[model samples]
Target: MLDQFLWVIFPYLCVAIFIVGHIWRYRIDQFGWTAKSSEFIEKKQLMVGSILFHFAVIPVFLGHIVGLFIPAHWMSAIGVNEHIYHLGAVYVGGFFGIVMFVGMFLLTFRRINNKSVRKLSSASDMVVNFLLLFITFIGIYATLVTNNIVTDFDYRQSISVWTRGLVTFSPDASLMTDVPLTFQIHVLSAFLIFALWPATRLVHAWSLPFNYVGRSYIVYRKHKK
Candidate 1:
């Protein structure tokens, strides 16, 4: 089936392309960091942009936990019904989507609008973000407009099994295709995003924010030789 072929190829290609691209890119970056100047003249917009990006990350992280880790019963026991949860996911996810979109758009525009950053920004880099935003738009619409879309009640278990297989370097292909189309796009995009993370300024996600904001540093005196 075309869907099955796409499911397998999409992930496989992302991994391969990422590995090969990273090796090439790393070598290139060793020569210099090519990022550009700031676009926002106002401090407030920059602050708000940073806030939106980080704020959205919370619910994004929580959604991963709930969808992949929390059992349905646990959610129900806590008084969160299925329909309500799905609806909440739609609105909350949309809020985060819009926030992230604005943040990413501004950041990308800054890169293009600023001469120094524009030179460094590549076709593939922009492609990755566009893919992410497109996938996210699909997710928002799927959540808001669809029903009977997420019929797989055992998604958590499947995710656990797939994760273990991936860790073992013996991933099971059978389980991968069972995911719903909506979920498939989301999962694939997330994986591609992760693969691309180390390559972009997106690696800023790993840096300590407090350290960045407050110039916090841990200094330990070295023992005398």
Candidate 2:
């Protein structure tokens, strides 16, 4: 029952909330869709945190795509077996996970400690940062200690299958039942983040800077007197 709710029902609920929430927010508050960056308040911390977080997170996000979306059979057909996959996931995932964790920690610390940024920050801002930190920390711990170092638990058959099922609109909650507790928490935390994305600065992700690409360039002509 618990697994059913968490894996099946909760995922659908999150997606529903994510879609509806974004539309509602866009319609009601189109002007406030920006990230509300606090770069002007403190540049040094922002530079370090933003660079580390964004750069590290891109690869980490791609790693999740490969791990969850790609089926094990596909990998096997390509000569990538469980052993090789697990090893790469451990070492490569661990390195990027640590980088992301540190980046998040730095950003959170900067947000909290910097008086100017803190003055402009809201309760929701803090909550978002804290949630992200917790999620990243748990993910790194699961990768390093729980699965890699201790047990070679190949999640492809369980979490990956369950996740792919969700993507295909055929959720199988039972597959998540046998997954480890830490892995379960990581998945749940991710859903929570997705659910909250619309309400937070994360909404800015939808906004693309397309105007720069197609807009006219400025021309300053010299006046001959």
Candidate 3:
């Protein structure tokens, strides 16, 4: 029952909240849908951290899409075996994971230590930052220590299958029942983030500035003397 709740019920609940929350927030607070960037408050640390975090996180997000959504059989069909995939995932994922961790650390530090930034920051902002940091730290530890040094647990077999099942509306709680504890925490924490996403500035992630692409460029004229 515990496993069923954690693996099946909890995930669907988070997904439902994630979907409905965003719609409600968008309807009521469209103007507030922004990252609330603190570049003006503290440019130096913000620039460095924002650059590193955004750069690393894009690939990390894409990697998750591939790892979770793409089936192992599909990769096998393309001639990529388990050993090859694992090596690539470990090295490439680990590198980006470390970079993301450093970036998040800098961002979190700036938000907490810089008085100007802290003054502008809301409680939700701090909570989101800390949650992200925790998730990234656990991800790195899971990749480097838990999966590598402690034991060779190929999550693709269990976690990946279970994830695909969830999206397809046929989740198998049994798949997640025997996986490592670290992975279980990682998955649950990630869902928690998703559940909270709409309420936080993280909602800004969906508001890409695509309008800038086709919009006319600004033109400047010399002022009359």
Candidate 4:
């Protein structure tokens, strides 16, 4: 019963809220749909942290898609054995995980320690930043310690299968029942982040400025000095 709620009911609830919240936010607060970047306020720390965070997060996001969505059988079908895949996932994923951790740390530090940045930060902004930092830290620990140094638990067979099942609307809660505690925490934290995403500045991620690619350039007229 507990497993059902945590693994099955909780995930679906978060997804539903994620979808509905984004739609409502888009319709009611279109003007607020921005990253609200503070680069103009403090360029140095923002530049370093933002670059590192974005650079590391893109590959990490793709890694999650591949790891959770793609089945183990698919990799085996393509001649990639379990050991090979695990090595790639551990090394590559671990590297970017560490990078992302650093980036998040810097960003969170700036947000909290820098009076100027902190003054401008809303409660939601601080919450999101610290939450991301926590998530990234746990992810790195799971990858390096649980997946690498500890018992050889093949999450592909359990967590991956369970995640795909959720997408296909046939989640099996038992699959997540015996996984390492770190992974369980990581997954739960991730869902929490997703639930908060729509209400936070994270919504700017979906607002790509594709129109800029085809739009005409701005023209400026000189004024007499």
TM-score pick, better of 2 and 4? 4
Best by TM-score: 4
lDDT of 2: 0.88
| Global Cα lDDT for candidate 1 | 0.62
Query: What's model 4's lDDT at 85?
Result: 85
Highest-lDDT candidate? 4
lDDT of each: 0.62, 0.88, 0.91, 0.92
**What order do you get sorting by lDDT, best first?**
4, 3, 2, 1
Clashing pairs in 4: none
How far is 193's C-alpha from truth in model 2 (Å)? 0.5
Model 3 clash pairs?
A: none
The TM-score between candidate 1 and the true structure equals 0.62
Tens-place lDDT digits, model 2, residues 88-114: 788998898888888899999999999
- Over 4 Å off in model 4, which ranges? 213-225
Between which residue pairs do clashes occur in model 2? none
lDDT of 1 by residue, 134-220 (tens): 766665655554434555434545654564555456556678676666656767777778667557655444335465667758798
